[model samples]
Target: MRHTGADARTTLQKGFHEPVEKPKRFYKTVETTPVDGGFGVLLDGRNLRTPGGVRLVLPTAALAEEIAGEWRAQGETIEMADMHATRLANTATGAVPNSREATAGQVMDYAASDLLLYFAEEPQALVERQTEQWGAVLLRAEEEARLSFVRAAGIIHQRQPEESLERVRQIALGLDDFGLAGLAFGAALFGSSILAIAVQRSWITAEQAFELSRLDEAFQQEQWGVDAEAAERTDRLRSEAAALERWFKALRT
Candidate 1:
């Protein structure tokens, strides 16, 4: 038996085959309230807290209403997967407070070995495609990120300049907790911090970034026929990237 992308996402959503205990929906109404700094969601008359027990105060009333809408949409059983906005807010409030620096470091590590920096040594067609598509993105990175990355022909380890890494680190560090979480998620999903940054800055749409990141994989799938599992993975990746793009936009506004 082969594990699938859906299987992995299921595991991520519902821990390791854990029993799904359906909590009875107790709240009659979901609403938003103005807090000190921002707004928060209220169920009935009680304020909603994150899984970490902190008051779920969002920076914007719009975002708070969005999260409240998620709660309102739930029926008898709350589908956690459907509440991506709430989950992202929870991460921004809970996890990111303690792990901001570490998370930024992890994203910087990805920049060091970014997928865009590696080119395939192959037939002329594939090489040309990489140069045309990936090359444009690299140039965008150089211009936007203000750093010149070292590209390599093959998998041989080539060290990126320290100045380039520092520039990326500076950009990552400048993002707020919500933006940081989205960037980390997007970078990991697409395997390119450049694409993730471009999407974050609205230079390109999530679909464009996903397509560019999977250029080689798509080429292979077209030539050799697509595997069911591989196609499923691509769908899941696109969905996640779209979600991240939405979250980033909401967070910025």
Candidate 2:
């Protein structure tokens, strides 16, 4: 079934009593309990599902096609080739085991049951959700940093707007995910570099580039440092960018 997760939980939750298909559940120490009539497998991610996105964790390509219709398809989806790579243990030599010694199908069914249960009740869909959120944080810091530099340049002299905006673009693309603060600092430096490029291209004067360069230097010293909570570091980044902007103003006068 193609799951859209339209009604998925807002955050990761453990409301499901069943398991989901995840590579991790194949081989981990667990304490099982017999309930109702069927076995209750002890797994968390299965019950908790994803943390943020509204997507279900699909098995990789190999697994998806392999178990397309078996009802026990999800586990069968992950080929031994893939499972071997992922480090699952105590699997059937040729198939999965339900408890001790069963055909691959039986083992596959148990695994599948857990997998489907997880998808039904989990939170976000994938790990990318976290990365994207962090990415947004970094992107915001960069935008404000660019704004400050442009303002400083205008206050110092009759700076051209098109040239400054174009410079900001180059730096924004070059930012690496060292963390939020690193991303912000990288963006500030990128802004400076873009201004330098404009200077080199005769788009802006060399003096303009030199003026922006002071802000870049300040980013390296202050905004670039790692902080304890990671996200909180963006405040420091903003402060540093502002400080550098001030320095640029002083230099201009």
Candidate 3:
């Protein structure tokens, strides 16, 4: 059986929750072709299309190859969740273009309540670690983006400067659809807009972002030992972060 771009998009939207009924691989060849915009993927001589039925054209040759590689890796059956590049490409080509403004707004929202802005007041050691790690990243975002942020000690909300948030909004608006999609994914995944931007800007690796985001959980695990469920969750998140990082790298190459 063959899969359509719409099928791929649906699988991505559902994520790993619902089990996808894998389809038998039908294409004998997966190759990259030069499209007018950049590069395109061809399977058995037919051009790949997006969920919206638009020709799937990537912005870079490297990215095209990455998506093609996913298709090439399929065995007797195709598993949509495993094709990270294709899922992201489906989003960029079909979903993101239509929701660009909404996507940018979501990123700005993440910046407003970024995880890095809050610190634990009770634990001195956690405070010191967060100050040392998250603080550094937040400071870099302010320095580089020319923005100001307010930190909170506990659950009470501290409003960031309006000027700073507007700057972040502008920064989000500046990205193209694909870039915005990547930014939104990273921000939501890491639960910190500053950390996401750090990874997006090449200031930090995906692994560092995961480590910084999981600081509280890691601290708890160290003290009380790890829960089986939490560890599994962390592993899944780590893999997704790495996949997003790979997608970003491919776009730049």
| lDDT of all predictions | 0.78, 0.28, 0.80
In model 1, which regions exceed 4 Å deviation?
1-26
Q: Write the per-residue lDDT of candidate 1 for residues 20-133, one digit (tens) a residue.
A: 776777888999999988898999989999887999888877778778888999999787766778888888888987998888886777778877888889967888998998
Model 3 is weakest, by summed lDDT over 10 consecutive residues, at: 1-10
lDDT of 3 by residue, 1-253 (tens): 1221122223434656766688999999999999898999999999998767888999999999989999999999988777878887888889888888888777777777777887889689999999999888888887898867998887677778888878877877787777777887777777766777888889999889878888877888899998887777677778878988988898788
Number of the candidate with higher lDDT, 1 or 2: 1
TM-scores, all candidates, are 0.86, 0.16, 0.91
Question: Candidate 1 — which pairs collide?
Answer: none
**Cα distance off (Å), candidate 1, residue 239:** 1.4
- Which residue runs of candidate 2 sit more than 4 Å off their true CA positions? 1-192, 195-228
Ranking by TM-score: 3, 1, 2
Cα-lDDT of candidate 3: 0.80
- Estimate, for each residue in 68-158, the C-alpha lDDT of model 2 and write its tens digit: 2221223424332222211111121112212222222222222121111121111233223323432333343346444222211111232
Candidate 2 TM-score, C-alpha based? 0.16
- How should the candidates be ordered by lDDT, best one leading? 3, 1, 2
In angstroms, give how far residue 186 of model 3 lies from its true place: 0.5
Top TM-score hit: 3
Count of steric clashes across candidates, in order = 0, 15, 0
Clashing pairs for model 3 are none
